[model samples]
Target chain A: MLNIKNLHVKLEDEDKQILKGVDLTVPAGEVHAIMGPNGSGKSTLSYVLSGRDGYEVTEGEASLYDHDLLDMEPEERAAAGLFLAFQYPVEIPGVGNLTFLRTAVNAQRKARGEDELSSGEFLKVVREKAKTLQIDADMLKRPVNVGFSGGEKKRNEILQMAMLEPKMCILDETDSGLDVDAMRLVAEGVNALRSPERSFLVITHYQRLLDHIKPDVVHIMSNGRIIKTGGPELALEVEKNGYGDLLAEVG
Target chain B: MADTAVLASKAPVAEKPRSVLDARLEALDLPRGGFTAAARADAADRLNAMGLPGKRDEYWRYTDPAAFNAPTAEPLAFTSRASTLFDEIEQLKLVFVDGRFDADASDALDGEGLEISTLAAADAAGDHWAADLYGKLETAGQNPVKRPFAVLNTLAATDGVLIRVTGKVSRPVHILYRREAQDADVTIHHVIRLEEGSELTLLETGGIAARSNVAIEVEVNKEARFHHIASKRADDAKVGIGHVFARVGEGALFKSFTLSVNGSMMRNEGVIEIVGDDAVAHIAAAVLGDGTEGRFHHDDTVFITHAAERCESRQVFKKVLKNGADGIFQGKILVKPGAQKTDGYQISQGLLLDEGSQFLAKPELEIYADDVKCSHGSTTGALDETAMFYLRSRGVPKEQAVVLLVLSFLADALEEIEDDRLRDDILTRLDEWLTSRASA
Candidate 1:
């Protein structure tokens, strides 16, 4: 349910282009993995879709369901059932993890014209979601991502995704800092959220993450565009040979 | 009291200069007759010599004292619906309206191992212990700064409280100041003494005068403990000028925290002396100024002296300013020559929410003992962009995210409060302030 048509993006301050006439779509109930080499505008696609600032969408039509995603603010996009698990989840001191999540959940609920959750209700739901992601109560009590290990941050992000239950989920290289065990736990958490009503766009630089989650569709993205589209066997081929032959074929 | 020409000439009690402060002094109704006569006369002579702090004064460089030097401060009224702070806590309450003590509304003046009396009620008690400690700390606290306003309060204050504690106080002594008079240019003075091995917690809120000057003198005796918390509740039209002079005795503890929000012009000054060996003192404040009602200016000036050996002291101040509001902090830690093995720390930080807001800070550490460890720091900046974005991307609106970041910046200062419940109470008011003032 995530669609981008003729997408073109540029740096806000400079004229340098990032995403040049790329087209991609992730249909409902499907998990699509976009494996790319470094500096292939993979991260830019995720950022632009999430409505981050400091990016000029030169020409694009990005939409989620019936909403014009590009015209909405970041929070509005989140309320419209969009979630982005960051590549590097930044540490924010002073805001306790529980309070941060509660504010986020309530803001989204309010934006969607839903009644807010009581404190007790919020604590219960968060504890359940956190347990699945191996996030203990102490982790929920501390400041958001402050003093957390890379694995803990990724788990925290998954906990957020579970709590929000967004329809269109975009995992932006969440496996970068995570170790083997952490990546499996993260994948399990992400895999749990997969339903017929939910879709995923997992942007990864390696095929190791897709091994645990097992994407339904694998797209070879190189030089700002998806050069090849195939099934799960394609991820195994790239893991065996890397992007060398794929880039050569695209060139 | 003014019979001797030599005494008046040396520190001319009547030969005052023509200035805005001099005019304000004329309007003040100084405590008259009986118990206050001698102290009031001496304070007048000192104030007459010093005059009021002018706009040109180095200490008032960032904040123009001229706003408070008029014949009478501008009257302000707060019509907000938020309830008063500390209303839920069980404590003894003393009410004052328009600087006059409201005896009918106050609690009974009887407690275990403690004695409490009004300054007016204690006028006839010649041997009262308060008489010995009254104005002593204020006079002793004046060192590097010429505190003319405190002196002016000593000479002009009409009514106040005198408290003495000898054992641990079960409940806090809350002074509830409610304003009933508009244009009430009231001056007040309070005297508190904690004897050896005693403990007391004092809570104060509201009743900051429309155009008010307040002075509190405290003495924590050997091995005694004293805690003071004051919240100058948000009243945009109010001018709250206050001073606290305290002395911590041997092996004693003196801790005070203040929360100031939305005052049009507020200047809070504190002078503390660690006079006894191994004494500990901490002073902290959280000031928030969102210039919604106009230019909100808050100034906190503190001077802490380490006169005894092995004593420890800390000064923590945090400010959140927006909409062109001004925040000023001047803190100094002084360690004497024999005050060896002293440990002291001071930090003042400001978070300016918008481009128009301003924060000015001056931190000083004067150490004479080579063996002591002391440091001071001051910084001013806006909220962290990464932190702001992270909060917003999580679906928190920009306004709520800003408040969250601002409060996160102020957590350290709030953590300095020794009591957990009191800190939470203040946090409630802090959130209310953000919702009401910072939303714009």
Candidate 2:
């Protein structure tokens, strides 16, 4: 379960609030979608929740599984079952993708006091998960995100999330820069990881991604606060009517 | 009483030789009417005039050779003892101890199309090519900022391995320079000649645990290809100084990769001259300085397109300075006037892991040709903060993340090596060293 109460965040050394007294809660076994227009602080909220540096949390309480999330470091949060699928993944040369994945997974395992996986066992699990994401074995052998296409990088992120198997996941614009086929494959990979004990926060500007991984709840965010909460039908309404009408309601 | 007197006269009395500097001069058996001997005399005279390079010298500013004045390595003494490192290499091994040829420890020259013998033997067998190409590429009495060590090597070197690849020698030739412990100084001069249209790979490993000085000269002929890989793993308590001079002829290709890992104070100077048109030269170096007192320095100068057109030269240097150690890289590329369409690129990069660690990188490009594409760049920086954060976010410990980043920084130089097995071996050794240091 994930909970946020009156979450207030602002850029360091700036007075402009990005997440203004926001409140949200996601019980296990549900997917939540946050939709907003450009400059609505959608990405800022994700970064604030992930505890990236330079985003000062002015006032708020965030908890994952009854543990204070704001007190944890980035790595500690990751090991605590919090995963953020980056919108723009970093390119790391000379570090193989599989090696990076194994290092991350084993690091989380070590932090959780679990035994480390052997090379053979890690490879076996990675190959099996990569099959669903349609990532070739050679791609994993190459350097992390080096020479990977836009869609391939997105898919690789999903592959990592699947490999990590985090309890709570945040997909940040996972559908951006993806063609129809790539979007379908990525959505399928996300859909395959869905379970009753896990939760996801899907952030996007378009409603197309929601068509594949239908969310149990849809929240319309504007001016750094959620103004509307409805069922899945709200997504279709926004796709057809656009945010212009929603802006009026929020204002 | 008469028998005792006779035995006393015949016994090998090991008198503590005079100053290593003086003993080196006395060991030379100069031959008459020989161009090599005349060159040696000229170099010795020039060395006497210039004297030893002090800390004030511009070239020796960063690396002071005066601290290495210990009288432990004597020059020009042939011994039966060979280096243990050569036992692992399966090739034609030539052992040189104290700047002289150790024939007893070396194998006989019986390979087909491969003339593996001493430089003196080659000259005696009417091999005029050996003498003609000896000092062709070295900085002899020229270079305003002269390297006294090179001058010393030229004057004091007695005999070294002279390998001629008449045809394509499939197996590599290993040259092992093993320095024994004695209360004296040592200087060595080596020459390698590859005939026209011949190709060979030469692996040179310096196993000098004692305080010693060494120099090597190599020459490659027209259309000949040579790959030279040199590794230095000297003792941590001793000082090791070495200089390598190479001449690559027209239409020839020469590639060199050097790895300097352990030494108290080590300096390797490499000079490459591309004399012929369409010639290619590549030089790569990786030095690792650890411990609080270790110091390593590398100075490489390359002269490209002396009289040739469309020649290519590349130089890359990577160093990791840890603890309170220091690493320096000085690379210069020279393109002559008539050498049009010359291509040259040089890059030097270093990573300093500690606050007390220091790295100095200077890349200079001097060009006279109008239609040349030459560029040189040097970068000195700490580890990437974003990358470090990303790795840490993935649950990798800080130390392991640093190791990965350091390896990534050095991967370019290691990947430039063409030999897969040698490259892998070097990488493995580097990884082991890094892991140990990380734990420490």
List, for all models, the DockQ compared with the true complex. Answer: 0.64, 0.47
For each candidate in turn, the interface RMSD (Å) is 1.2, 1.6
Q: What are the models' TM-scores?
A: 0.93, 0.83
Q: Looking at model 2 chain B, which ten-residue stretch has the lowest summed lDDT?
A: B11-20
lDDT of each: 0.85, 0.75
**Candidate 1 Cα misplacement greater than 4 A, ranges:** B1-21, B80-83, B124-126, B436-438
- In terms of docking quality, model 1 is medium
Per-residue lDDT of B1-440 in model 2, one digit per residue for the tens? 35335434633431221243454455544443244766667777665555555465567667766544443342322343443443444678776665567789777765766876676565456535567656544554245346666776676555566666788886778777765654335555567788898988888776554555666666778999888887775333446677777778889988888877646677777777777889988888877777554444444443333446888888888887777777777778878789898999988887887777778866777888899989888888888877776676666777878888888888777876787776776776677667677754
Give per-residue CA lDDT, model 1, range A147-214, as digits (tens).
99999999999999998889999999999988899999999999999899999999998889998988
Native interface contact recovery, model 1? 0.64
What TM-score should be assigned to candidate 2?
0.83
The true-versus-predicted C-alpha distance at residue A164 of model 2, in Å, is 2.6
Candidate 1: clashing pairs of residues: B30-B156, B177-B207
